[model samples]
Structures are given as C-alpha cells and as structure tokens.
Target: MALPIITGFDKGDTMKRILTSIFAFMLVLSLLTGCGKKPVIPDDDDDPIPTEFTAKVIGNTSGNLMNGGQYAEAGGWVYYSSETFDESTLTIATGLFKMKSDGSSLVKLADGAYRSINVVGDDLYALTQDGVFTMKIDGAAGRILPGISADPMGMILVLDETIVFLTQSGEIYRNSIDGKNPKELADVNAYGFYYQDGWLYYGINDASYTIRKVKMDGSSTTDVSTGGRDFVFADKRIYYRNMMDNANLYSMAMDGSDVKKISDVDVNSINTDGRKLIVSSFTGVRVLNFDGSDDTVLSDEYAVTLSIAGDFAYFVSQDFSPQHNKLSLSSGTLENILKVRRIDPQNDVVMGSGISDPYIVRMGDWIVYRDSGELTKGIYKVKTDKTSKTKLIDAYAHNLTLIGDWIYFVNDSLNNYLCRMKIDGSEKGVVIDLPVNDFVMKDGWIYYTDLNEIKIMRAKMDGTLISVIDDSDALGEIKLSQDFIYYQTIGMEAGNFGIHRIALDATRKFTYLDDSIQSFIVDTEWIYYTTKVSENELPMQIVRMNLDGSQSVVMDYFDEYVNVIGVGDGMLYFETWKNEAGSVNRMNPESGQRQLVFTSDLRNDHTVIFENNLITLKNNEDGSVNVYLSDLDGNNRLLIVE
Candidate 1:
C-alpha cells in the first residue's frame, strides 16, 4: 500500500513551510547535483537540529490477492491457478481460476489441479495433474493431449494453427493449438519471440540473448543479432538500448546489418506513428525523423512515458512540482508548434502564488475554480475565456458547487469550512464549515459523508460550520434535498464488506439498506449501486437499488468482472474486464443500458473525475503508469499531454 496523503503535507502556506525546509535539505542533495559544498562542523556546545517523522498507510489491497505463477493472455481472460495456499498449514493446489481484468467476474475453470496455462485464439491449453489438456474459454469440453508432457510456459505464438512453446527444462517444441505435430527446436531456452510477416523472430538464451529467424516451415535458422538488452521491434527494425556503460539506442535492419547507435544517455521508450520516431526518457520527449536526425524535445514537462498518435504526442510529466507544470509541445529541434495548451490559469488569490486541483464552475461570464494560493487552500475566480484571475479568500476549498453569483464549496483541508465567492473573483465570504465527503447539493443544504458518518449541513452563502444533523452511524455518499438527506453505510463483517443506510436528521434511526451490497449510490427516489454474489467463486453482478433500500435489482451480469464505480450526468461509469482483457464502460443510471467507452489489455489502476465530456484516468500501458483522458461515450481516444 502507498501513503494516503501526498507526503502527508497539507497544500498551501503549509507548502511554503515545506519550501523553506528545502533550504535546510540542500546540503544533503548536493551530491545528486555533482556539487561539493563546504561543510560546517557544529561546536560541542551547539544544539542539534531536530527532525520529526511520521508514517501513514493508504490504499487498501486486502480483498484482491493474486497467485504467483506463469500465465498467458487470450482476449480478456486469464487462466491461472485457483488453488488456495496456507503457508503455515502447508496447503496448495493447481486448480484453474479464470478471471476478468477488473477483477469482477471470477470462476473456477476446472477441478483437480494444473501446473500452468497458456492460451491462444479460442483454445485454453494447460498441463493438468492428469496430463496436458485443452479447453474452451467458457469452460465447456476438455480433453487431454495424449502422451505429451506439459510445457511450463505452454504456448508462445501461433502460425497457421501451429503453436510454439517453451518447456521448463530450456527446450522448444512445436505443436498444434489442440496438441499435435510435436517436435523439438534443439536445446535452447527461448525467452521471447515475435512473429512478423512470414518470418518468426525469436530470442533465445544461447551465449547471451541471441535472436534467430526461421521460416514458417521450420527451415534453416539464421542469426539476427546477439549481445543486446531490452529489445523491441518497430518500423521493420529491431531497436534496443544497451545495458553496458554509456547506454544508447541502437537499431539494426531486418537482416541484422548496418547496426547504428541513435542516441547516448538511455532512450527510455520509442514508438513509431509511421512518420516520426517518438522517443522519451527521464530527460524529456523527443521526435526524430526516420533517418535518425532532426530530433526535437517536443514537450517541456519532464517527459517520462509517451505514445505518439498522428501529429500528437501523449506524454506524461514526472515533475509534480506545484509551481512549474505547464504542458507544451514543439517540433523541429525544440521548435514544435503548440497544438493543445492546457492552461492552469491562476487567479490573484494573491500574486506569485501557486494553485493545486482547480475545481472550476461557471457563473455568467466568469468561470470559477477553487484556488488555494494565498488564503491557505481558499477559493479563486477567473473569466471563462482565461481573461482575468483573482483570489477570493484564504480558506481550504473542497466539494465546490456553484449557485448564482456565489460558488459553494467546502474548505476541509482545515476544519471542514464551507465558503462562497463571486464568479468574477470578488465578494468572497464564508458560509459554514462542516465535515463531509462525497457531498451533493439539493434545495439549500450540502449533504455529504463526514468521517464515517453522514450529515446534512445547511449554511448561508458565506463561510461557517453549520450542523443540520450529525448521525453517529457510519455513512457514505450522501445526497441532500430540501426535506431529507439520504446516505449509505459500509462496515466490515469479519473482513467482508457490508452495507446499510440512514436519514440526514439525528432523530431518524438508521435503516437497513441491504444485508449484502458491494457498492451503491443514492439520489432522491432512485439508488444506483453494485453487488457481488460469488457463484462458482466469481462475483458477476452490477446492481441497482431504490433510495429506501427496497427493490434492489441486478442491472448487468457478466461472466467476467467489473470494478470501480463512478457516476456523472445520469450515467454510471466503471471499468469492466472480460476474462483478463480490461475496458471501461458507462451505463445509463436510469435504464441500466451499457456501452464500452474504452478498452485495452493493460493494467488501468486509476479512474478520476468525469469533467467536460472527458474522464481522466491513469493506466499502465508500456512499463510505466501514465495519465490519459477518454470521452464520456468512450469514442475519443486518450492522449499523452505532458
């Protein structure tokens, strides 16, 4: 698990204190800058500077536990060991467990036990306790491949219905996807392979990571390259970065001749959009012509991971510094055009101040976003066309809602203070300070979850802490109305998640929302939520419920799985995975109709807020996690804006 807070420091003037502390830390960081600083020895009578330290835990990962073993991907499904193990009890099994990418739908594929699994096309191949066998993805009919020992790393790639695989003892074999034409490829440990056109390029452990080519007919072998590290094929050439001193990008032809070094100092990852070679590392993102000349740093941010689409380069910035993150792109030796500029325009909360997490709202010609530069995480306002900016107050802002000329928001970084400010960055004042999370506004009050409890906090359009009702029972996701507040409660029953509900007022006792529910949301008469009932050891339902905890129904059921629930604009969105192939889906909260907005066979661990027809998310595409944006309908693809 990672830390809950970003280094546990609050944002604002608190950040100024942190900046001041950086000067004290300068002596320690001198070595990283290759600078030698004169050291001053303290006198024996001098007092030592004291340092304080604390640790915070975040990100609960208790539910999802993965079994360690060799597995292969086929479509969206992963077939792996389902055998539960108790280390102290010495229990293990080889049974097969099939699951989707988002960890929703899981099922036991087969009984007994198995060693490992490899999948291709529609066939599931594995070595069972009985023998090597083949099955369908949906767990229908299965049969053992007679007399064949199971390859630990079962299958690699397919060519004309024939499967090539690696066994545990560093041997290669060729067979049909359904197990036939078994033959050995001498005695070599094949680590990786790529099938392009009619030629099969495979990397084997000979002397030191050698690449050899063979025809589809298993004819004579030809050596391609040897003594390279971290190789990838792109644009009909094998591009690899050296592991030895003075790392550089090196590329070779298909026939392994005319080997050339492209750049020194480690090119991180390279991609080709058919025209330009987009390469990036810790330094920045760069675009190069095919001939390896005219390279330009296309981005100003600390470009770490990148993907190129057409003329746009989607790059992620690693520098999370508060003051200096303006994304810009250029071409032609650090002179590219600035196509899309995402300006985080700052208002004069106070001049020369930095703002973080802008929550913008519109009122008349002025667009308002919470800015906390001067007033310690307060509210700020600016024009809609990026014309002017100004700070309203020095209060912590959270859960912002706009009403008429004033912007309603919670300044909770400090004692849950409610505040309001004009859209034109003027007439800033306080409303109330109330503890809340996941809040919604209805009629006049702000209904929200407050520290494991749900409450309705009513305050004037100024900053103040007003308590409408502070219920004791834990609640989450509160929605407010003129007369009532509806919320949900979550508790642990012997480590299993349970759900409940209650009203906004302290007089109304808690109500039984559901005996069992995974997650749920409420708005007036309707309640939208999800539930999981393990049938065959796999949870398979995304459910909905009424506000009164009655008439709960399963909206969508799948054989795979769905995780992460978010709702916006009457649409419920979550990431769903069939088998192990992951995708994002959005459904009509009223009709429960669903559509796949984005899909990929990658690890997507982040789903941020839905804003302006775009949902920001972070996914691990190449080797690093990167931020991306997808549309509400999931039509427009994500891009890397540094």
Candidate 2:
C-alpha cells in the first residue's frame, strides 16, 4: 500500500483564512450597531466607502482535453507532461505541468522524469523512474506505491477503483488505487493497451504482432485474431492497421467477427470519437464514418498522431519543429495551435558531401544554406549577428548562388525548376522549367547544366533569351570566369573526360584544356584542376594552367584524393581523403607551402569558406554529425548543431 511521504496543510489553512475574514467583518458590523443608535448615512454626493474584492480560482467548462495519459483534464484544469529536446544529449527532459483550458495560470507541479498521469477523483496517479506514485490534485502528499515496479516507459489506466498498467518488461499488472493486492494479469511484450468493460485489449510485439484480450480477473486470455502495429478501440469495435497487408486500415467487432478492410492507404495512426474515425496517412488526414465509408480528406499537410476532440482534430506535423495543429471537421480549416521553438544553434551549417555545390554560402552579413533537417529541407538565410532567420523557400533547394538582390537555387521536386527569390524571401519565381544539374551566376547571366537535356545552357537572370552554349557532349560541373564559361564534358567517344571552355559570346569555339580532369576552379589568370594520374587511381594532382592552355604547371601533388574547395588570400583551401578519414588544409600555390587547418576521422568534403570563416561537418562521438565553424587557421571552433 502507498503511504503519504509528504504531508500537506491538513485542509485547515484554507478554512481558517475564510473564517478569519468573516469574523473581522462581523465584529466591525456589531461594533457599529451597538455603539450608535443609527450610523450617519452617506449622501449620494459624498465620497463612498470602497468595497474589497478577492480573487477566486475557477474551473474551465469549454475546452476539451488531449487524448492520452501524457495529457489529461479534470475539474477544468489540464495536466500534461512537457518535454524539451536536448541536442547535446539527444534526449527529452520532461516535467509535469498544469494549466487552465484557456492556457492561463500555468504551474509546474514536479520537474523530473514523470509521465502517464491520470486523475482519479481528487488524486493524481503517475509513473516515474522511481515507481508508481499517487498525489493530490493540488500537487501535495505524494507517495510511491510499495509493490509497483518502476517503469519509466509504462502507462497508468484507471478502471473503476482499480489501476492497470504495464511494466517495462511487458508484464500487465492491476491493483487498487492504494496499491493493495497487486496481480500480474499477463506476460507478453505489449506496446499499447485499451480498456473496455471488464476486458483489456493490448497490442503485442511478438512474431505475430497480434492483438489479444484478457478479463479483469486475470483469466481466459485469448487472441483477438487481428495483427497490427497500433490498435484503437472505439464504437465497440477494434480499429487497426494490417501490418502484413500493406499497412491498410481494418476494423472488426470486439470478438474479431466481421473483419473488413477500411481503406488501402498506408495509415500511420488512428483516432476516433466513437462515431467517426480519423486516420492519418502518408498523403494527409482522412475522416471516415463509423463503417469506414464516406471518407474525406481534411488537409493535405503531413499530419501524425490524430486525436479527435469535439468537432476538431488535433495533430502534430512532420516538420522540423513537429508543431501542434487543430483542424475543424466542419469547415475543413486548419490552424496551428502550438509551435515548438527549436533553437538549432547550427541550423545554418551544411553537413553533407553528396551535394556538388557549396551547401553553405555567405553573402555579405547573411549566411545562406540548405537546411539538412528532416522537417526543414529548404534554403534558409540567417544574419551573421543572429538577429533574424527566415526560410526563403519551402522545398529541397540546392546549388545556391547570389546575384544582386536575387538568390538563385535549384529545386529538386518532381517538376524541378531553376528558382530565384529575393534576399528578403520575396519575389520568388521559377527562372526556368528545366531541371538544373549545377549553376553559377556571371555578368547578369545564369550558366547551368540541364539535367534533362544534358547540355550546358545560359539564360538571363529573368529566364529570358535562353541558348545552349555547348551540346557536343554531356556536361557535368559548370564554372564561370571573366568572359569564358568553363565546364566538364563526359568522354562519350574517346572515353577520356576533359575540361573545356567557351567564350561568353560564342566567338571562340569549345577549347579543350586538359584530359582526365576530375574537378576544377578558375580565377582571372589561371584555371586550377584536379586530375587522376591513372585510370584506376584517385585524383592526386593539382594542375594550374593559363586560360589559353599555356604555361601549364603542377602546383601540388598528393598521395590521397584531393578536391579544391576555394581559393583566396594567396591561399588555396582544399580537402584530402585517404580512406574514411580526411582533412581540410590550405596552401600557397606559388610557394608550395601547406598548413593543416582541420583534421577529423570522418569525411569533410562538403565544405565552404567565406570571409575568413571555414565551415564543415564534424562527426560527434555519438554517431551524429553536426556543422561547425572555425577561423581560417582552424581556431575558435564552435558547434553549429548536434
């Protein structure tokens, strides 16, 4: 049995305050009446005596509660477990809190690993790392039950005067609210459970992954004959997804009779109001009648964990923030109810090497980059002083470049387009309809390789007067310098890939620079390129030559594969890879002097340098990679995200 560990004010303090105020009022009134025959009444024009006003706490009667043990409402106040995601630890810190339905008078009850709170009459039962505990609704007199095992991932379900819950090892147990005569009802790896009448139905995680039911007296356990990932009990029927059959929704009676397929959509979760079923799928959310007919999609946004309350459906979006939203079933309207503010200190850092362009770029005081987070995989810009950050576009954007007031990028959507938007995230429009492989801006013209046509093309900033610059062979990476457009052409005929350059005006035809060129960058006077010494070896040499193919010289040689990232300030910044480990270094091409800037066990090929700041990806000890910033010489290191 549970015993009170912390005693509260024995219900006398509140009554005493009320009694004291009443006694004071009565004494003043009796004294006034006994001392004088009649007290002088104040005239209407005279000053009036002020009356005292006392504030009172009241319960809400309008707002509905979120459906779960993590959040419950009783007596007009909602108690919930609030969590904060810690990037450093990659975990959530949770605590118990309560607030009015109108989101007022918020109070924190306890701060620790507490969850699965259920309000039974005036007492609140919860599960913590220590054990199952019971407390008053006013957050006092907490005591851990004696015989209950501590299961942090367990849940508490109240049925009549008995409390049912699951242990961490998947054992089901039931006992009185005071924790007397505990009984182990079943032994199975159950992930979820629902209670109805005198029976408990739970979803098991064995080889069959089936749903089973058992009586309240812990006897006659039987399989429900339906397998699924998640099960919801409503309308006296079981609703679940058929994991063995394409993850479609199915429904049946309590006895597993008249089993029917509801829909062929891939359902993520299900919710119900006993009359209507709300289903969340890959496409969006759908509402169906009790018989799974007359289905209508409420919204096309990515929604998860559908919870229906009244005529509204609440869900969390599959976004970077996982924001909470409410949708009206009547009007098909959606509104964001709560926004999770994720202070991603490194949201501006780009950390993947698969992209061919610089994932992170700097323009003046603003840093622009592709957001690698699952929820916000688009182009974003943030101020260097950290004053503001805005998402310029809401798509998988890449190959970022800034030309004047407009920022150009490539969208990798189904219908892919060359996109441009203003620096302030305004005037967004498609520059061209074709998919761009890689692009660079020079002299008010955009040079790119068309993924669909496999040709090097040019177009004005507004997408006008488009023309192909080179179509002799398929183009790979494109670069621009002065009056020439330099690009790599695949070796289709001779099987020897080479670098080629053409004048911007088509006056000079395609001029071959070198064969077996892997990657290259061009400056005003010279072109720097990387080439494989042999057909089977990796890129090992940095060769520099004049624009007209004269004065060719080997600037540097490396045993490992090398890539040139950028060149400035009389130094060349590059990355080298010998195997799984790599390093970023800078060297003077003229002096042949090199200095190691940063070294890591993981690959650091996706890197960019701007304004004396070097940005690259760094792998953490916990198998997670984050973007980091350092000075040009590899000092002042700071993590962007983890």
TM-score of each: 0.36, 0.54
lDDT of 2 by residue, 1-642 (tens): 000111111111111111111123433442343421121222442221111211121111101111234455667776665554332322234467777754578787776544456776777777654556677777788887665553444456655466667665567776555554466667776665666555677777666767788876677798887556567776777777787787788888888888889898877667775567878787898888877789999888666445444466656665422445668877888876432222222222211111135467776777777764446556777766554777776666668877666677776531246776677877666667566778877656677887756777887766777898877565577777767777777755653377777777755866555477777888778788888777768538998888888688898878898888778677888888887878888989888899998886536336777778877644344423355667888899776543
Tens digit of lDDT per residue, candidate 1, span 462-534? 3223465654344454544334555555555331234444344445544544445555544556666555566
> How many angstroms is residue 155 displaced in model 1 relative to the true structure, after the best TM-score fit?
62
Residue 549 C-alpha lDDT in model 1: 56
Give the winner by TM-score. Answer: 2
Where does candidate 1 stray beyond 4 Å?
1-397, 412-416, 433-438, 448-465, 490-510, 514-518, 535-540, 558-572, 577-582, 588-593, 599-632, 636-642
Off by over 4 Å in 2: 1-117, 124-147, 177-180, 319-321, 340-557, 577-642
